[model samples]
Target chain A: MHPAPSVIVFTVLSGLGFGLLSFLGLGLPQVTGWEAFFYFALAFALAVGGLVASTFHLGNPQRALKAFTQWKTSWLSREAWLSSLALVAMGLYAFAAVFLDISAGLLGWLGAALSVATVVATSMIYAQLMTVPRWNHWLTPLHLLTLSLAGGAILAQQSAVALALLVVAGIVQILHWVLGDRRFEERGHTIESATGLGDIGAARLFEPPHTGTNYLLKEMVHVVGRKHAQKLRVIAFVFMIVLPIAVLILLPQGIVSAALAILCYLIGTFASRWLFFAEAEHVVGLYYGARSAQAVAG
Target chain B: MTQLPETSEKKLGLVIDLDTCVGCHACVTACKGWNTENYGAPLSDMDAYGSNPSGTFLNRVHSYEVEPRAGGCSQTVHFPKSCLHCDDAPCVTVCPTGASYKRQEDGIVLVEEDACIGCGLCAWACPYGARELDLAAGVMKKCTLCVDRIYNENLPEEDRIPACVRTCPAGARHFGDLGDPSSEVSMLVAERGGFDLMPEQGTQPTNKYLPPRPKDQLPDMDVLSPALEPVAGEPKGFLKWLDKALEAI
Candidate 1:
């Protein structure tokens, strides 16, 4: 089925951690205080946790050290190298901020680059998988940006500038989802054409590959109805992407509504990611007579 | 470092004819036999004789019923899937250790099983699902295209072919230098319009499958399957029980 949860947690948690660090990197002279130090510490914690969580998904966790050698051609290797580099940069920035005799300006830019590096590396992992049609999209990068924005906004009780960037990120995320969903919808026909006899209109299947169930039928061909998927998409829109934006917009006025929105976005995004994997159709599934039923109906 | 010449004899590849394949799984069996006998390890069958079982084979035949589109009969497409030994293999790139690598001279992708630690990322990275984990060996294994047989200089020149291609009864499998445009395999591709499995996903699979021929070439199965032969017209046959059992009742 899907990749393990430890990986999911690592990606999401590290996203948030890096977003917070990026804002702290801005280092506005007007804003001087414990808030910067506070956010910095928490962000570093999440980043470290994300790094640790990555190993759980590896079959041979020890061999992960060898990934650093292939940075010339492999994106996965680049991601590993970048993540470790970011980890080091963020630590240096933290030390410079709290205990060292260092200029605030230098500390700020370094933190910013590390934050950006972390998110970019995170996005590259899925984008590099040319085998997966769903993940290899322009929206993949946008998804990371939006998710990071959402994370940044959640931690934005202290800064107006960070809060503003979060709003922009939220809008971009929503647009990316809307556009990406349309692109994915058009794919049913391409998939139908690839497996069938190239006539998009006339393709029909009166039979399946086997009389009883098999792994391909179960794992690839889910009998989950389209109506259910649409409903879930709506839930993802409102709670995961939209609600957090609304909460941040209204947060200066109220407390309870803001708290509720934050809670909703977290749970909603987790479910959306799960659905992302669940609904993905591997072309190997097509060989086993799992045609796009939606394309046929349309 | 020792510098090396990059060019020599042409690297041979397989071109499978989709039109003639009967989907009999003969090549699969032939591959298992040759690999077990000659290769480093035999294809192990787990619980094969006892109960539910499985084993490895270099090639597998998959049969599909293709619906008529733009006025062709509902046809049967017997396409087989395997490793393409690509010029640029994603499976080679993502190997954490330097275990999986493409040959420097030829474009053959291979795994150093000794260095591999049994991670299934190579399987995940391959869009074609070409790689499979050798559960007993605690490492991954895949189609080597009978590398041991074809490359051995001691063998006679006529015997230098992949085992599966050598054993195919229908002559459906063609082996030759795909790099040469005038090669039989290359000309076959030019004549038949060989299609890549998933070009958009774009692993750039080297092996090409010619699209299935028209359904007219297929014999009428309704008449053929039922009319293979009659039970040798004799007394006290298994069919006599049908009449006696019904008469008694």
Candidate 2:
């Protein structure tokens, strides 16, 4: 699993954006007039900008419209549709709140539900991949959802709720890492099973198919050192959860403290998201004999 | 549609013989050559002939050393891999663009290049690493099983099979309707004890691989003792004279 920069940015920013939008839809902070306009603008920029950034990784962005057609089977398709619907519903809600000086009550609730669903859809894009054992877990969606809500609560200035959600997100993040570490081996994919040669003996890759790198090796066989990953995990936990909690609790309640907390949380979330993709071991690596017992154990 | 058909009319796939493959990569070459020119998009290479070359290949031959558990000797097995065209092809169902689909008619999974968004979800879904995103074409590529030539009536009847199967010098590759129990491939699988790769993955792969036969077995004979017998209990001509001369010296 290559920790593609574009995908990382998309998931992180969009998760935050949708989380913020969900809070806004519920009239958290209950901003009106210019304040409502400012919040909506910020939300739209983050959400739409993340969506645009996602297209950067696509080989053919021109044909991305076709991506919306396969929601019945594809999680990516569902994410696209859900995100678009969320944005549209939020846009209408924003227009009413900003211009008409009224809360489009039913529409705002619908938008909030869609916003959260969009984040779930995004998580499913990775969770549904059975080939990547680490991502194929019920905890994957739970981790993303918790992070989204926690980030949303912080942005909405719901300090008490944000503090609790942040604590839950931190616990879920640790649990995800602990369980995900064993998933590849637990899936029972090894060089022996991959090649169907365990009956003969222990199999090792004698010669690779090509001398040069291929797409599979480049994309799925990415190796992240265990020590480096461990350091990043601590950094992520501190910034995303601990620092935000400390800022909200210790510092006097002010816009400046909330801004600082948001900045710390975003940085931490980005680091964790990078690990999410980097640490994932796709089963295909077993065939290449790249994911050995030591690699899995790490 | 990205949704898989309930049942394919025919399970058309390859039966690879691990015993026979010499790791020549001839099938790989033939597949790349034929597919680039004939398929929806030409398979592309990035930084080719440079430091760090990479390309999209539908088929590749990997070699593995299997050490016998009984401790006789290690054997090198050449494993040629490509799309298994699984009955439960995960790649097909994961395609967001509906570009990837399995043909209900022939059971050959294919990527409709025009509709492809190049999101690469299909490639991620495949456990075999069967699908590769064509870097230049910006579309997914996989072993089509030579769909173009297999069904082309214009080609000579003998040349109708997949390019890999036809080009395999060792006859390691076989192509047929595995859905039909009476088919040559199905019978070959049954006779040779052919098995699927990663059966636990439960792809129910249409492709089958016949395991390699045991190697390095020898009869109970002291081969060196016969040579040590020294015909007629003496060294022959030159050897006999040399022995006498050496003894005198």
Query: Which has the greatest lDDT?
Result: 2
lDDT of 2 by residue, A1-298 (tens): 8999999999888888899899999888787799899888988888898999999999999998989999999999999899999999999999999999999888988999999999999999899988999999999999999998888888778899899999999999999999999988788888998899998899998988988888898798888565599899999999999999999999887678878999999999999999999899888888777766445645
In model 1, what lDDT does residue A101 have?
39
Weakest ten-residue segment in model 2 chain B by summed lDDT: B226-235
lDDT of 1 by residue, A1-298 (tens): 3535776677777777777666666653213336446656777887778778877755456666776766766566667777677667766766666655353676568767767776776676666665555666767777776677556556644335444655665565566546655554455534344443453134334444223443233434454554466677778667765676676666663446545655776676665665555555555555554545646532
Candidate 2 displacement at residue A44 in angstroms: 1.4
Predicted model 1 interface RMSD: 5.4
* CA RMSD of each candidate after superposition: 9.1, 3.0
CAPRI quality of model 1 = incorrect
Question: For model 1, how does the per-residue alpha-carbon lDDT over B138-207 read when each residue is reduced to its tens digit?
Answer: 4566777778878888888866887778888888888877777899898998998876666665566667
**Per-residue lDDT value at A296 in model 1:** 51
List the candidates' TM-scores in order.
0.76, 0.95
- Score residue B20 of candidate 2 by CA lDDT: 93
Clashing residue pairs for model 1:
none
Q: What local lDDT score does residue B244 receive in model 1, on the 0 to 100 scale?
A: 80
